[model samples]
Target: MSAPTLYELDPADSGIYRAQMVTLTDKNPYAASVYVYDEDEYRTMRLLVTDDGKAGVALKGDEIVSVFAHKDCAHPKSVQSMLSQATALGGRRLDCFDTVLPDLYADAGFVPVARLRWNDDYAPDGWDYETFRTYNGGRPDVVFMAYDPDRVGGDYTPGVGEYVEDYDDGIARAQRYRPS
Candidate 1:
């Protein structure tokens, strides 16, 4: 089969999910709903809540699906903040990719899973999305991280280092896990 639709631009800008850019409808911290594409391309409506005085993302309608902590109930950015959120979310795993910092993710009880490999300038101007995607590398832009609860609040060295430079190796390793 052909590649799954990486994204659908234009009149029906479907399949493009950007959680980092999510902003709730209002300042209501009690419940915030957002639709974002998980690392695996699965479309999901992530819910952010603060009923328990901690900011967390959940899957099932305001329920803590995963990733929660003592957040601002507004927008949390720190890895430690995320860790606290995850723990508060009732032990849900933090399985996601971070283009910013893999080392910091490791410190937050996440294991560096796979290194993403996406080309620069993938999204060009002038509505040239087709051209960009045609040559777009399927690799993610960040390393996939999986929470290791036992390793939380502790300094644990990742089994493998970050930044997979070899193109072939990157593809192979990524394929093996197909991390989301």
Candidate 2:
């Protein structure tokens, strides 16, 4: 089998990259891990941080290897289209969001889901545990992946304001994969 392609959002992390890493650790002091990958055998890793102050990078031994670039990350329009297709297949994509205007989300075909923390083991923070563990399971840490959905025909970038003007929309399906 062929080797996997090394993917990244930001290849040159440099000073800014380290800062983002520190933020993750600081945010979750009790449980933290850094992801590091082998760049020699595979390609280099690049990572991109989203506007939401979160980047979808896995935890490795010491640091997260850069593998994905935000500049190329799927646009909001693509993600929304993908979600609409999934709905026809009886599949659901759940997303948790803040600061989104309720009406705008509704226009974009999104419904809110609870912010749940599912297990006691992950809920070391008593209050956080109690607050989120309304259901049976728990996963304190989660990652949201980049949007690179498959389109029906060849790639098509809509005209500026085309989507909003043509379709009543606001949010993107990418939010469905957002980390809780």
Candidate 3:
């Protein structure tokens, strides 16, 4: 099958917006409508494929597919193609929260940097802090992983321990700086 064509959905495109809303809702009920709405506001990108005789979103590329599949699909050539397309028109970085994609991104020459922690003030009511910590304490949810376009063809060696050590150093530094 031909790969689904990618398109940047305009925020004003109600049909695409609604389709994405429906897709997000069906796939992830826990996600708030505001999440989709906000994503539309900022990064309006989607991959469309015909499913059940209707246009629907699919994994943008094999990397995303492998992420969903929870396995490694290291297609270096495919990664290069997607990276080229993404960066051709001035792309920043590919942002994804799925754990599986981090390794693939690393293999594709993207460096896995420190994960982001959402402050407590930003969390919604009824959000499970303990559960969240248990599930993602060591491995944070929002990780900034990216490949340098200049060195796309080279192998990437990820510093897995760096994230942990950095977190510890940050905590120690903050404690030391705190007023006693």
Candidate 4:
């Protein structure tokens, strides 16, 4: 098969990308909030769409506050394309979960900074085990990784206008990964 082509969607037309991402939520729960961005912030989200995949990123100056890849397009090449585009657009620091493209991210110089586990033995601070179990949909461990830690810190904690936490507790605001 031919390689999938990536297209950069206009910010004004990002609704279409959001709609597509929502459709994937049935199988990939993380898709529900992958592209959620605060309206008040001066954040410009660059969403890259493909025939079989998609990726969304929000860059505030050089820091990447939010980033996610559509389940369908989380493969090596597609992910490489997404990362390349993000880097070119001034995303120096990336904080994302390793639920999807863990190997790819590692190959690209990302290191694990935190691990989110539903198990009480290793759960992060303020994590509601039962709530995370439900929200995570049986995915036991979600590893948080960061790229370029020397320049940008690998803090997985959500910031304002970045990730929306539907639950009342301190699990990841935007969920990632549901096994197929």
Candidate 2 residue 155 C-alpha distance from true site, Å: 23
lDDT of 1 by residue, 61-105 (tens): 212233433335444444365444544554333333232244555
Order the numbered candidates by TM-score, best leading: 4, 3, 1, 2
The ten-residue window of minimal lDDT in model 3 covers 62-71
Better of 2 and 3 by lDDT: 3
TM-score of 2: 0.24
For candidate 1, what is the TM-score? 0.38
Q: What residue runs in model 1 are displaced by over 4 Å at the alpha carbon?
A: 1-21, 24-46, 52-54, 59-99, 121-141, 154-180
- Model 4 worst lDDT window (10 residues): 170-179
The runs of at least 3 residues in candidate 2 whose Cα sits more than 4 Å from the true structure, single-residue gaps closed, are 1-15, 21-44, 49-127, 134-180
lDDT-wise, the better of 1 and 2 is 1
Highest lDDT scorer: 4
Give me the displacement of residue 107 in model 2, in angstroms.
Answer: 12
lDDT of every predicted structure (CA atoms): 0.39, 0.30, 0.38, 0.46
Q: Write the per-residue lDDT of candidate 2 for residues 53-162, one digit (tens) a residue.
A: 23333222222233222323334333333233333333333322121222222332433322322233543332243333322222332221112224222222111111
Instruction: Estimate the lDDT of model 1.
Output: 0.39
Estimate, for each residue in 23-89, the C-alpha lDDT of model 4 and write its tens digit: 5454543442233444434225656556554655455555454445554554534555555566667
Among all windows of ten consecutive residues in candidate 2, which has the lowest summed lDDT?
159-168
